[model samples]
Target: MAEYRLKTPLSNEDVEKLKSGDIVYLSGTMYTARDAAHKRLVDLILNGEELPFELEGAVIYYVGPTPPKPGEPIGSAGPTTSYRMDPYAPILIEHGLKGMIGKGKRNQDVKDACVKYKAVYFGATGGAAALIAKAIKKAEVIAYPELGPEAVRRIEVEDFPVVVVNDTFGNDLYDEGRKLWEKK
Candidate 1:
């Protein structure tokens, strides 16, 4: 495994260098979206409508953060289970989504999309929401405000931690880990 620090609007080269189980600390801007926002995004794509944000080389985090307390950019920003977004992930990837940050396994179609499109799936530490929030320097809802926490937000992060769960080569960290345990 390798460790890399990457800036957003990731290129094919950026994702190509990664391997499953590699460590990554991402910096720069990324967007937040859960199931609801994902549906809307895919719908816009299918309908040939303009999206709220540019999709090229973008990273999406599957999170619906808690409201900030007294003064903070965001609060308790943990990853949601990835499967919920599987239905729409491939379409997004095909449209130039470069990375995803979430928890748990992804469906085969999503995995295939990553391999075909030079995208990657990243896993954030699920229980470390408070700790993760510290890396988010700024957050603003860019769309779907009525969804509250589910609103799409553009966030700026610095050295935000993640693990490469599925890489462009189609390697899956979760599967590799399971195989290692089976050998034990």
Candidate 2:
């Protein structure tokens, strides 16, 4: 149940120190980006357009959710499947992106980027929309409002729980952890 508050972008060393099942309380700043957003972001890089935000040590959360209720800032936001973002992740990692928040498996290049750039890929529980949404305290769109669900947002989260999926050293706890349990 260790807690971490991210005031600045996290370093690779900082990411690796985290292990599976560790509770993370991320704050300061986080950018929300889903499948469409990822595509646009990578395209920006390819075109040499400046990014809307700094990526160094930044954690990108993959989510596309229902519209928020009138008074709420967000609605039913949960970790979406991570595999869809894999193709563009390597480029982001190269550009100083340090952390990613999502659920499920990632490609080998993404893992390789983790090793090469000292980044980490984190997984929040899937199908726990209501519970996970509680971690988010505030939300505001920072880019691509026209994209609807694909819009990027700046969100503030408290006591956000996440597990380290891929470590900078190339260890995948998802596979290893499950295999260990399966052997029992």
Candidate 3:
């Protein structure tokens, strides 16, 4: 495993260099989207309509944060369960999405998409919302404000930590780590 400090709008070259179990500290821009936001984005694609945000090389973080306190950009912004996004992920990946940050296992189709598209999935530590929110320096709703916390928000992060759970090479850290710890 290696360590990388990457900026958002990650390139295929940047993703290809990562492997499962690697540590990554991401900076720059990333979008926050939960299931509702993902479905909306996918709907736009299917309709041949314009999307609110550019897909190419974009990183989507699966989160729905609480309302912020005074002087903060966000509140308790941790990753949501990733499985909810699996149905829409392949479609987005096909459209040039480069990275996803979330928790839990993704389905086979999602993994296959990652390999085919040269993308990667990073896992954020669960139950660490307060700690994670510290990295988010700025946030602005870019679409679907009606969804409230589930709205699509463009965010700026600094040194946002994550672990490579699924890499472009098809390695899955959860599976690999489980196998290592399993006893006969």
Candidate 4:
């Protein structure tokens, strides 16, 4: 019901204040890690190895960006389907990840993690990659460069647009909107 401008490394209090369907323009640092990167990150955690980046209060965006053209920070930075990252999400959430940005629905376990951990799931417009790219001011591959597009990148964003799809309070915008718009 409200719009908020958020910065990365959000606190539990910051996440708890968001609700499903709220519009958010996020700034500051966020990580990009699709399926492959997520698996690797989890493996690092399970093996007691130091992660390439800090996880506490971090926001991870599920994306496998296109190779940038010369002189661009990123290209067609679209959100990947979030479900593909579901298997690894809860593990990351348990370790202090505060938010995720992606597209499509996440499983119940992922939602449960959001509620239990006081985190949130944000949805970026699936087909708006080109527009999204403009918000990314800087990008640098932090690990798994061999994964190419799936490589984990640390990005700085300015007013990166997204919507609250799942909130810490256990509300799901996809489900709530469906219930409201379905033919009676």
TM-score between candidate 3 and the true structure: 0.99
What TM-score does each of the candidates earn? 0.98, 0.91, 0.99, 0.98
Backbone clash pairs for candidate 4 read none
Better of 3 and 4 by lDDT: 3
Worst 10 residues of 1 by lDDT: 175-184
Candidate 2 has a TM-score of 0.91
lDDT of 4 by residue, 104-171 (tens): 99999999999998899999999899999999999999999999999999999999999999999899
Task: Give the TM-score (vs. native) of candidate 4.
Answer: 0.98
Taking the tens digit of each residue's C-alpha lDDT, what string does model 1 give over 1-184?
A: 8999999999999999999999999999999999999999999999999999999999999999999998899999999999999999999999999999999999999999999998999999998999999999999999999999999999999999999999999899999999988953
For candidate 2, give the lDDT of residue 46: 98
Off by over 4 Å in 4: none
- Candidates arranged by lDDT, highest first: 1, 3, 4, 2
Candidate 2 deviant stretches above 4 angstroms = 1-8
Clashing pairs in 3: none
What does candidate 3's lDDT look like per residue over 1-184, in tens digits?
A: 8999999889999999999999999999999999999999999999999999999999999999999999989989999999999999999999999999999999999999999998999999998999999999999999999999999999999999999999998899999999999999
- Model 4: ten consecutive residues of lowest lDDT: 32-41
Candidate 3 wrongly placed segments (more than 4 Å): none
Q: Residue 39 in candidate 3 has what lDDT? A: 94
